[model samples]
Target: MTFAELPRMGSGRVSEARRQHFHAQVQEVVVWMRQYVRRLGFAPVARSWLYALESEGKITKGDFTWASKWLADRRKEGLIPFELVGADTTRQLTGHDNFDEEATPREYINRQLRDSLEQAAMYWPSSYWKHQTNYPILWSEKKDVLKLFKPELPDAIRRFAGKGQADVNSRLAVVQECQWAQENDLQPVILYVGDHDPSGIKISDGIAGNLRQIAKVEDWECGLDEMESDGRIVRFGLNADFINNARLLWIDGLETARDEAKGTNDLANPRHPDHGKDYVQSYLLEFGPRKCESNALIANPTAARALIRDELWRWLSYAGHKQWEAENHDASKEAAAAAEGIKRMLAMFDSAGVLYNPGLIQSLAQASLPGLPA
Candidate 1:
């Protein structure tokens, strides 16, 4: 039987088959275009361009114009995002015949490395340039793939270990340098720079601990002592002091630590002394009353009261009205009362132009009181 004489299928069945075929074709074309664009740094041929190519066997002025308009329309309708390809620009370069394979491997590597470096630099600021070092060399042409350290290079070199790869030798070198500095009576200081997350803190702690042990054995002061004395260490950044000084107080857990600290201060000096009251007050007011309950409030009632007063003073200073009542206010309403108190305190800060990031506050608050309603 001839193809034209073949019996026709039901309209519904034919439509379903056509729909499946069209979907498959579209998916195939999308995948191909994605690969082609990534390699050629531009979009592949549009539908009209493909049709023209199949019809005319080459791209012409009229075909190019039609394809451009078709692609523009698709883009306008959000069907496709437009991009220029090699073919689009090459048409302008009349003297340029074709791409040549004469480019050296070194040139290509250099170009790629430069581009990668430029992209990486965007994550950090220009101030980081002072800490940049030439060590921890990235070796692209070696079995090991990286030359971690060179003995002749200066100590305290900052190096990038590509994703998932830690430079053990470089870390060991830092440890060795710390030991040497201690032996030579040179104060050893190692400032760790990493993300402000838990893993980063742990890594820094491990490094500091190792250096401390090494310094003790060698009877030398190692790791930041010298830098601190000389004022070379930046107080900011992810340093040991910054981490240690940080108080991880949450709204719910405030009473536990505040009460403990207050008890210690009260027991240490029971004479009702005014000294150190500021510190005690800060703990109670900023962390205790708002976040914790009376029972959970730190044991030193004096300190707790002082803190509450200090927070009240801050609120008052910022134009937070102590008597301002929230809408539908009822002293008997527990949740509303709590929320009202918080809003009043926050309003004080807001009035004073002190903006607290709600997202961060919410996150920390949630972490502190996992079961409490936000």
Candidate 2:
């Protein structure tokens, strides 16, 4: 039985019939979740999965907290594959022991050397935006939302601006990126995705100003007006059109950082300190009392990926791809020339009777090489 159906701590026992019903429901949920995840192809975050189920009438909105806990327990018991759920990068393990016990120290050294050699053989031109006039950075308000569509954004720098405004570190990183891009004769641009809410709308609108402010503090002299005039910082998703077309879920209430801190509910409420703000008033007039999160796009992964790809294609032109192909051809020729030089160097070592020495190879793997990081 659900929590609401349970008796008070010591009042009475549950009927066996009700108990059986709860068990049957649990089994049905498990089977449905398996099939659902399998059909979806990619694992969505827990909230998105809940939204999908709710939309299909498999569960009510009230079931979220309990269902999430139940699903997590099942995953922990190994009833579900961990890969069936997207990882939450917020909570993480760091600096932990990550050694492999299956290999001996000598075997590990051999594997490392072989891996390095394999990488050397596969070298290509490393620049992704090499032929593009403008370098695009994919910016999302939420990290979880960004993770949903990040794989399709291969040609852009991915950045997650956490809740509300970006942190100081995030702003500094973008400023440094813009500085480097300008130095290399590239124009930096941001493709933004955020919720369509009071704060979310304003957050995307203020990104250029945020970057410019940080750049100025660092003594960088570049005009961000071009980013605005040329439509560089484009808010491409979670807008009214995308939400309506994608059939996204709209959440009730105008929640903000202040509301969260104060343990209050809606920012549009008269009692809210931020209710009188122009952005809040505008959002309320435009959207009523509901807001759609960018995460709602996670319910349809195919459309989500396509949305990002279409925006990227606008900047990545046909001419750019041809230029990239030409650059790759030249890079491959240089790689072949380097390979010949390496072969000659190895032949000299072979002539000296030391090319096939296993002991020397082991020593070289253990020692730090010259002109490389230690």
Candidate 3:
């Protein structure tokens, strides 16, 4: 029997089995057609097949006409395949009309798939670096030196002597700067110039993280605290008064109180004699609000200058220490060294106090600041 009249081998009704066999035959034909089209490097066969199916009433004539014209046009444009018809092997077959201009179903499906894949790929994390340079004057006469900061800064701080705002502005600036650098095929190196303080350190870290996230450049560098080429460290400018206020609020009296209260105990009950819980609670309540208020007020110029000078001195000393270590020591080593150094310095301070001398504190401060003579 011919291919269409052959008996289907299966345990179903004759018509059902025949239908299944017919579907399988159609699938095989499609597979063969694909192979034939690939090997012959032609597109007219797809149009011809659609036209034949339409004539046989298996598909709509409109669809067949549209597909045929699309294939023909694409083939002419080198987007589809075509066969040479003339002796010169340059002329192509073209006589059909009533073609549809809309995208074919298969083309539409492919476009959607491609778009979905692109969107999925986009969700993957990416990073980049953004560089900035700033120079703050020392009382208005210092030459401008390069100091970098990231992402991008706000319009306020975009130029010199501009208003410095929240950490968010600095972070966003760094990110924007990094994007600009990446587009221009340059690496970012952010430099900042500011007074030293806890907030400055925190801002540096924030800018670094923000740039790293935006550019998807895990290897990219962006931060104000980065070291300069000449081995000097850069930092975000802190309000000198803010640093002083923060030191007074967070560090100063707590260390003294803890030290002085070390051996004092209630002699009443040995098991819980050292429970200075009441004193600790009182310290927290009394100092916490003042510290919070100090932080809030220092950002205001009117309140900033009134910050205690001794607290500012302590902050400057601490900041100078951090800058020195960031410039001269490896980060991991610096942490360990700093801990040891602090322990040694504190012991020296205590020793000096017992001997009624203040030279040890000065020596420790000098040691912490990088450029000070040994």
Candidate 4:
């Protein structure tokens, strides 16, 4: 519901009834968040939960600061588990090693051995994307997106262009990977996701131009211009339709990194420097001053994942890829069988105490190779 729909409060003293009503709303929000956390099976970032609440009409963009503090308060009060809130890895300290110990070292070794054997039996030597018609690289405008979609997309190589622009080193590395893909006769394609703001839209639209410039300056073997001509960069998310359909919340003002850093209103604001620029004017006319962040997509996790997979399957089918992987493993069945046989032999040697008898082992080695000196 919009702010206008909310119950108006008197500017004077808050009545006991009004206070109780506000408390009831906070409890409702907490209960809803708990359900959402359970659905996800893990604590996502606080903003993700906020977006979810926004989509549900339980809160608005302006409620972020107040809601965030409320959530933290509830968590501290033991109404919510601490694990129900995701931690920021950026500020985490390094060189920390803390873990639950197993019953014993031998038990750990046995468990590891069993895991190793299982993996060996199922291992495939071929690359996951070997037979695909196109080589796809997943790109996101923000690094935080990596947390939501990366786990589901194991085979796709990921590149994060933080704030929609790749630095020189990142550009060089991605281009090199694309070159390798091209050499293998695969069409290099970048499946991109970004915000639904002016800069985001412009960056998505300019991906091919940027890549073309990179390839030209680097003098790469593959013609990125010709390759990208067939709509190689696919911006498959955070569009107007998706935002409306998903019921995402939009921030009221147009704010950029510079505006944020300088603590000033800029970008599309009337008092700002570039408000009258064509790009700014066009964006303001089309999308207005409000902007939806790409992180808002995390609110609808299943649909967001489906959107990614739908684009991915255009180049490679999930069933086809799995079948190919199984076939590759089957082709190496002899290796697995040999490994099993070797495991059995080692077990027998250990049981017979032959492994501990160094002199016996030397004699056996000499017996196998008669030319060895006594």
Q: List TM-scores for all candidates, in order.
A: 0.21, 0.76, 0.20, 0.78
Q: Write the per-residue lDDT of candidate 1 for residues 1-374, one digit (tens) a residue.
A: 11111112225546777756644543443454455445333233343234223222333333445555645554564444455221233245466667535387646644565555444433322221132221121211111111212221222233333222235555455556645544555444443333222232334435434445444554554343554465332212223333224321122221222234334323124333422455445444433422311111112223323333332232122221222232113332554455456556756755765434567666767897888676
What lDDT score belongs to each candidate, Candidate 1 first?
0.36, 0.71, 0.36, 0.73
For candidate 2, list the clashing residue pairs, or say none.
none
Q: What is the model-wide C-alpha lDDT for candidate 1?
A: 0.36
Worst 10 residues of 4 by lDDT: 1-10
lDDT of 2 by residue, 196-237 (tens): 998889988888777777877887735466667878889898
Q: Ten residues in a row with the worst lDDT in model 1?
A: 139-148
Worst 10 residues of 2 by lDDT: 1-10
Model 4 TM-score?
0.78
| Leading candidate by TM-score | 4
Candidate 4 residue 161 C-alpha distance from true site, Å: 5.6
For model 1, state the Cα shift of residue 186 in Å: 9.2
Task: Give the per-residue lDDT digits (tens) of candidate 4, residues 1-374.
Answer: 22322223347899999977765655555565577767766667776666766776767789877777766776686655676677777577689688637787656756677678777776677776675777788878865566667557764455664556877667777788788888888878888899988888888777767766678777873567666667777899878888887766678888876654334665776767767777778999988888998878767877677777778778766675777778787857966896798679868977987755779878888999999887
lDDT of 2: 0.71
lDDT of 1 at 198: 28
User: Candidate 2: where are CA atoms >4 Å away?
Assistant: 1-24, 34-42, 60-87, 98-106, 257-263, 322-374
Identify the superior model by lDDT, candidate 2 or candidate 3.
2
Residues 248-320 of candidate 3: C-alpha lDDT, one tens digit per residue: 2222222211222335332112233333445444434443312121122222322333332222222234444
Please give the distance, in angstroms, between residue 9's alpha carbon in candidate 4 and its true position after superposition. Answer: 18
